[model samples]
Target: MRLGWYSDLNKQEKRTYWACFGGFTLDSMDSTIYALMMPVLMTVLALSKSDAGLLGSVSLIGSAIGGWGAGMLADRYGRIKVMQATVLWVATFTCMAGFCNGFWSFLPVRFLQGIGYGGEAVVGAVLISEAIKPALRGRVAASVQSGYAVGYAISLTVMPVVFAFLPEDIAWRAFFAIGLLPALLIWFIRRLVPESEAFQQVSKQSRKIDLRVIFGGEHRRITLISTILASGIFGAAYIMITWLPTYMRTVLNLPIASTSGYLAVNIIGSLIGPFVYGLISDYISRGRAFMLFLICQTLVVSVYMFAPVNMTVVLALGLLLGGFQGGLASGLPLAFSELYPTQIRANGAGFCTSFGRGFGSIMPAAVGFASTEMSLPVAMGIFAVSSYLIAFIAAMCLPNATGVDLSDHPASVVNEPSPTEAALKKTPAVFR
Candidate 1:
């Protein structure tokens, strides 16, 4: 649990890390509940693969809107403010989703919740990305994402308890009602979390942070590539995660609650993966780190779906399955912040990642569509491996920014490491 990467952080940065880490963990927990409940929902609501896929896709589509709008608001108001609002927003809607009896009623609730989920992910990353020193940026910013695995592990542990005690139908509702717990984070944030200093500098200038800034001039390419990279990275993930529980239940011939052991291993691997990924990224470069994971994912997942292995072997493979998948997540959050300046930093990163969610959202449904023609495992494996391959190509195009200073100047989108280190040496020791 001890991380050398965090030792250098000041008190405010430490608080910021806890806030983002807590928020991202709960966000993963809340969002993951739907997937875990899929088997029951399908039976209760008379759903199909396509229906389940649509629900997953709908939340992500909502996230696309939420992430960008929250980013714009974060740019204007402040990161802490927007983050607080998002946490409250997600908690309210996630509880509401449990009340729905059918897909028609549940769809809109999921979308509204998606808005909060998407907003929390980007705003917190931006908050911490700006807080940490450049040398530790990739390691610190990306390691915060491991909170996703922590949240997922919580869900895996708690869901079996809910199912074991509650009535068959009501268990899912109790699972969702538990989601209301994340709202408690707001009090901690209001008391302890500080607004990003980078944002404070941007606010003092009173300049407008329009959406066009990211798409204009040299930034246009960065935005396009990051979006593509996000879609590929997250798309593959959504394909596997959105359908994983059901795949285990129906195809693997296990009960919904019974498969938790396998998933627990995967989640444990997920917890360990990002920390290792952060170290790799900080030392090697973000793009190279991504290339390594993406390639490994292609191989591991292929073996996961196709290898004629026994259950014991598959259980062990779950470790690698989760590790590579969890590791793939660090790139967008870290790179997006570095790809743009303070004026449009949140907006640009928001646009790329949010829209990446938008495009990636379809992959779950695509898996559903593909499943109609082939075995479900074949479909998921194809989509997963293909998505990573595409993302790997995008990684090749990424500009390295490992040591760049995150100045709030109108233009600090420079992606090279050395020039920014030299520039920082010439400036005041403190940002003021």
Candidate 2:
């Protein structure tokens, strides 16, 4: 029997959802593969913690530029085309990283890979947001974002096997090599996903790529607020997500196997978080949902970093922290998608998320720098809480746009449909 959000979608809509989901899953896998290898890279390459952190930051910087560029290109060209290009771009560079023997060689490769990684995120989110009906938008988009955890889980699960079977020098290289396989996902995307009807309709009617559209008049306030919100969330998220493994190993003094187990438990929570946020946002309001998550996540992360616990207790705490913080990961994309019109939606969403990543990208290097003076946990805790607080404040000022329609122009802010609204009778309940 038909039920919930999936029941409302047609076959092509379903395909679009899965294709974006798969793309995001692979994107997460390829982007984070470097983090998984950092410890090994440090040992074999004789590098320092700061050097490793700088490598991650460089990629995020590239992501920022690529995201903004691709978003603009997607508006001018098409979302699907940009998505295909980004996947191939990252896949090729990631494989080349595996072949590099030193810092100078790997730096350029990772930076290029970062560009594709950032582009994929913005374009894929735009594709899914444009394709889904308004009512199902939150749940569907959040579900796709949840694929980050799925991809993280896949990498975490495979790391041990790859490291164990292969020789030490080549094992880390193999992980990067495995990232190239996502290039094949482009085939499924090309075959199964169709162009967004909303995008196609709007593209035919609009020609200008006015970057100023997001910066002036009514959009000005939203642009600032949304960027701040993105900054806080991505800032806190990167600090914790990128460093948790190292934190466990260096601070808590856990072995590699134990660290992987802890991260795996955290991944399970990450998987559950987005769905929770989506359901709450759909039923309540997006602003309230963001506020709730930011507050809860702040507390969870603070405790996870500050509280002293046994290994079993730490695992339980990791799960809680992961669910809350991971859930927060979906808020910005969902919020950004609802804030702008179809004509410039990709550009607005892309700039906000990528800009935030650009701002937050500083955290890894900042944390690494601080680790030289203070405990890793303490340095992370300070930055994380600060970022979350910023997001909480921004969420308070954000407009409640849970049911906003993307297919319409700015003047017409349609409310959820009633039974008497003839056009919406066949639409989902949450939308109408």
Candidate 3:
């Protein structure tokens, strides 16, 4: 009975939903493995705090470029092909990092890995959004993004077990080597996933990649606002993930084991958040739901920064803050797809998300630098405040997407040009 029900659902939805979820899950797993190894790597390499931060920044820089590049490729080629290639690219580079002899060798390898990481989000999100039914798009997209939280939890659980038996020098290598496992998934993805029908229908009509289209009259304001909004979310998220453990250890005086436990709890909260927000967005307006989450995040993060240091309070705050912020992962993908037409959908989403990735690259180091002069809480408090402010601005500027079917929008507006339509107009068919 259960199998029958799932089969029915699968037929009704599309393979792209499962494909994006699986790809994102592996992407998250690969990224978190490196994050978990950061402290160990720092100690083994004798890296200065600044040098360690720079390594992270380089990866984000790589991802920003990858994101923009992948989006363009997806529009020119197809989403499935681009996604499969990105997974393979990251997995190959990540495995190579296992063989690095020193920090210098590892730095370049990690930057290359970032390129794959950057491309995954843009490709995966557009693929899923375009393939699924309009009514189910928000929920399904949220579920896909939620796969990241599950991947992070799996890394946290497995890393400790891997470390227990292995020495430090070899353990990092083992983690990197495990990253290669995702490469095998490319074969499955290639076999199972198909190009989006919507993309195919639209691409037949328009073959050109027009830069002027994105910055032209209708899209310019929305594009700029989306970029700013993504920057705020990415900046806050990267800084929190990178520096939160350090803050817990240095400021709260928690042992490494206890801090790991707190992080595990936070990740659990993150796992739940996207699904909850997805359901809520389906019932309420996406914009309203986003604004509510941001407002709650503003209050919760401030309390988290300045609250008294009891274990119970800290754990509660960590869970709430993590959950609220993680909701952004779900919201942005759906919002971006709805904001643009198919022709420019991939590019707009890619550019906005990647631009944010570039800005986000500096946030962790900025937090670390600020901490040297100001109190840890003070520096983090500023970050929390700025995030909420920007989120507020984004919410205000964002157009309401509630209950609108993207297919109803004009093909030229969204970038979907039918082959017949192109032939009628004597233009070449675009890549589908």
Compare the candidates by TM-score and give the number of the best one: 1
lDDT of each: 0.83, 0.82, 0.75
Of the candidates shown, which would achieve the greatest lDDT relative to the real structure? 1
Query: How many residue-pair clashes does candidate 1 contain?
Result: 0
Candidate 2 Cα misplacement greater than 4 A, ranges: 1-3, 203-205, 410-432
Which is the better candidate, 1 or 3, if ranked by lDDT?
1
lDDT of 1 by residue, 98-185 (tens): 8999988989999999999999898888888888888888878878898999989888899999989998789989999999987896
Ranking, lDDT, top scorer first? 1, 2, 3
User: Tens-digit lDDT track for model 3 on 1-432?
Assistant: 464222445652556667788888888888877667777777787765566667777788888889888987887787888898999888888889889877799789988998998898888898877776677777778878888887787778877777788998898889788888977975496568778766776645474566667676557766787777777777778777776776787678876578789998888778888877887887875766777888888888788887666789889988887788778767786777776777777887888888778777787677767777888778877975796688667766666554356565425543344222322243222211
Error of 1 at 306 (Å): 2.2
Worst 10 residues of 2 by lDDT: 411-420
| Higher-TM-score candidate of 1 and 3 | 1
Lowest lDDT sum, 10 consecutive residues, model 3, at 423-432
Per-candidate clashes, comma-separated? 0, 2, 6
Off by over 4 Å in 1: 1-3, 203-205, 408-432
Q: List the residue pairs that clash in candidate 3.
A: 202-417, 205-417, 341-414, 342-414, 343-414, 343-415
Better of 2 and 3 by lDDT: 2
Q: What stretches of model 3 exceed 4 Å from their correct place? A: 1-14, 101-103, 253-256, 408-432
